[model samples]
Target: DQQVKQNSPSLSVQEGRISILNCDYTNSMFDYFLWYKKYPAEGPTFLISISSIKDKNEDGRFTVFLNKSAKHLSLHIVPSQPGDSAVYFCAASPNNNDMRFGAGTRLTVKP
Candidate 1:
């Protein structure tokens, strides 16, 4: 069973527009959520994270909103840029060591 799921495999958005990515989890024990961005063959880098204790976290153009009741989370990027084109992964950790990740969502920002 996929503990975490990203329904869309890819998304395309125009530069300067907004890009939204969604994720859902079935594991209720997950207490920590994180978003990572990957480029080409490189490893994923941390983008933003939110704990189950909070509802939302934002950093500059990136924002992550978590709804514990619904077991859902989403990432929002404002003024999407060409540089934002990459694979985005949503991860959740109930314990400290093991983090479950979604297959990933590829975002293509067109200029």
Candidate 2:
């Protein structure tokens, strides 16, 4: 069974708007959650992250929210741009090297 899941396969948003991506985990032991953005023909790059101890973490236009009790996490991007179009993956780890990743959500920011 997959430990991490992204129910939405894709999302579309207008440029300069907001885009939200969601992820869920089945493992309660996961302590660290991370979001990565991947462009075509390139590797996934780190975006934002949240620790289990905190409910929310933000970095500029990117924000990550975690709900431990619900085993859910989400990433929000404000003022979405066409450059932000990419595949977003949610990854979780039990504070170790073993990380599990969601399938990924393709976000298309239309101009």
The numbered model that scores best in lDDT is 1
Q: Per-candidate RMSD vs. true structure? A: 0.6, 0.6
- Give the residue spans of candidate 1 off by over 4 A: none
lDDT digits (tens) for residues 10-98 of candidate 2: 99999999999999999999999999999999999999888899999999999999999999999999989999999999999997578
Clashing pairs in model 1, backbone N/Cα/C closer than 3 A = none
RMSD (CA, Å), candidate 1 to true, equals: 0.6
Error of 1 at 78 (Å): 0.4
Poorest stretch of ten by lDDT in candidate 1: 94-103
lDDT of each: 0.97, 0.96
Tens digit per residue, CA lDDT, model 1, 5-48: 99999999999999999999999999999999999989999999
lDDT for residue 57 in candidate 2, whole number 0-100? 99
* Model 1's TM-score against the true structure: 0.98
> Which segments of candidate 2 are over 4 A away from where they belong?
none
